[model samples]
Target: MELFIRPNTNEINQVEIENETGTSDPVVVSINRILQQPDSSYFLEGIIYKVPEPLRSMNSEAYTPTAISIGPLHSGRKDLKANSLKPIYLRHFLNLAQLSVNTIVETVQTLEQRARYCYTEFIEMSRDEFVELLVFDACFVVMHLTSWQYPNLDTPNAVNLWQSWNEISHDLMLLENQLPFFLLQSLYDLFAPSQPLLEHQSFIQIVQYYFSEHKNPKLFFIDIKPLSVDDVKHFVDLVRMPNTRMYSHEKSDQRLLWPLNATELHECGVIFRSGDGIEFNDQGGCLQLPPIKIYDDFEKRVRNLIAYEQCHIGNELRNRVSNFAVFMQCLVQSDQDVKLLIEGGIIENYLGGINEITQLFNNLGKHIFIGINYYNSDCKKMKDYCMRRHHRWMTSLRRNYFSTPWLCASSIAAILLLALTLIQTILAVFTGFKERS
Candidate 1:
């Protein structure tokens, strides 16, 4: 076991504790206990993390949880207004589960160390405090998700509790403010044990509904496809799960460069139609994008998911959310590109003006590391289409002759003038031949 000593922290005079068998100084005993733990279960890496500085600095507000916090990272902020309500929710859940708060806390205490290991850093809270936090947070998730399951039924506290649903939803999806999925599931099962609240209620359905706008044929890129909840790590991971479910491109490994941006691609005869029913295909580079509305909150949600992927060692193919962000960034360099996408119905800009939407996507991939785009084959295919001689010739003709109104008018006038001259010459020749006769 390794001991990390900070430069200016309390100094240690000796390596080994003087009383090897007996109880030594309190600090020494703590250090010795930590060192004696097995090496195989030392540190669990990449489940959760503080956002990197560059990303955090871009828009610190996006990373901050506004209404509620789930885990230790943002648990006890004084500014959060929802902290007082946490115990109420916990008590409500306890009543539903038919268990006392003490019983639930003790149950959670059993999983304390295991749950602590799920985090990237060491948690500093005592055992009782950790158990309390877990019980409270886990209960919050269960109650929220369960309540959302019955959307049609009006709840008593709906208006007062979730007046700013958007704010709380965005905060929940943040990378750092997440509890492990298993904890939430255990609590949920206990709360809903043998009591079917609805005929076909599911945890996944509740989550999808919570995040979904639920418009017919949802105007956003929500994966309605049923996903196994077992594989999910947290809320951010669950939200991004759909994007990464794309079939592995046959040439996904190939370093296929992203094709030309929107205008250039259009010039090359590559059409950008809205993908109303776009399916995830293994064939890369075919630009099939689900229509998405770019609202003010869009950047916050997307950035959090990307930040989560950036922090973890994740599958390249499964990191489709990050890949999509990078892909969109490559396509949109300016307001004009955003305009093009808007025209194609690929992006519904509800964020008011085009510039804000443009800036949102442009800044998304900054300082983010990405591998070969999952759409490599599609890019290659587009490039090949662009390189076609006929397409190239057509593009040139459009650029040169038919580009402007004046050019079109001048070409038409020249053709008309040539026709007139030829007719006159023919008539003169015929008249001269007749005179000779």
Candidate 2:
């Protein structure tokens, strides 16, 4: 009954619209293309990194360079105020190295690729630009460090430069703002004094000398050992390495911790005392802490060191400073804790209030990727003390009865009154029994 229309032979063919599963999305295609591309090769892993967002957000000022830019990451930051000084310092270095501009440029050009390889990411600059930044930054850093070590031989400009050292030092320790250690060393050796004032002193020693001035001078300068160049990656690393040995390497159980804050520990009858050494030790749970002078820019230095450790992809850096940061974060959880530490001379709170110190520590080590628990034994000791029945009883007695003179007097009066009532009741019962008999 169906009528089929066998119409004209030139009828257009019916086209069906359907979803095409085979067609690739532009994003997918691009990603696949990138995946198919050959991996970029470098002789060395990049040691520097732009501090990630989580850490930067916590304290934006800590990661931002305030005075100068040392390397490519922050090289052309618009806000950098020390650009004018770089060329001046470079000129001084040229005078010291005794190498012509063309010669220094050529030497750096040769090592340009290797130096680039030291960075973790591909630098977005031309070959000329990259080489220029490396040569300029390296020379500036080397010259700056050298001038400090040989102050007697310093130029007028060098002496003036020292005036801005507080800012310069902060800039140098930044995670993103760093040059390769070898590059600086090579530059240093090329221009080292004909008759060196310090024969065995290397660039690391010079750096240690400059940066360590803000730290406990007794610990930083006394019998300070020279660091080998092979393991160090940059100036920030050089700064971090000296304090790595501060802590003992003893093992501790994580679960067995004296996790009490300072006030609580004090309440638990634990004494807070200053540590013997002039620096904080990360040894397994040993409660030794060096006196910390919390200057205005202290957090910036500590944050940058931790960020560098987090960015660097190996145990070569050992993550000791970041570990110390984590340990401190764990140690100071409240304002009361800061007060206890201050009383103990373990923390010199120059930044003013207890809350400021608390926030400073709490904000640190958030991006600490490496896991190191150095205070396990110290925590365990405190935990054990807290768990003891004798300590608990004493603490309860002191808190309940001996807290103040008024409370003590009230408690004594109540006890005496109770005794008198019991005596009267016993006498009345005995008298009643005799009358009944």
Highest lDDT: which candidate? 1
Evaluated against the true structure, the overall lDDT of model 2 is 0.69
lDDT of 1 by residue, 1-437 (tens): 23332122222422344357465676776676556654534244337777888889889988998888879998889888876667777767766567887778777977776677667765777767888899888887777767765643334576686577666667787888988877776676666664566446667667777777422124323655786766767777777765322433543676757757777776765556676533323223246666777766778888888888777774543455677777788888888888877877888877788888878888887888876576776777777777777776776777777779999888789889999999999999999999999
TM-scores for all candidates: the values are 0.81, 0.76
Question: Candidate 1: where is the Cα deviation over 4 Å?
Answer: 1-35, 39-42, 151-155, 198-200, 214-229, 243-248, 276-286, 314-318, 388-393, 396-437
The sequence of per-residue lDDT tens digits that candidate 2 reaches over residues 287-313 is 456677787878887787777777666
Q: Model 1, clash count?
A: 3
Candidate maximizing TM-score: 1
Q: Which ten contiguous residues of candidate 1 have the minimum total lDDT?
A: 1-10
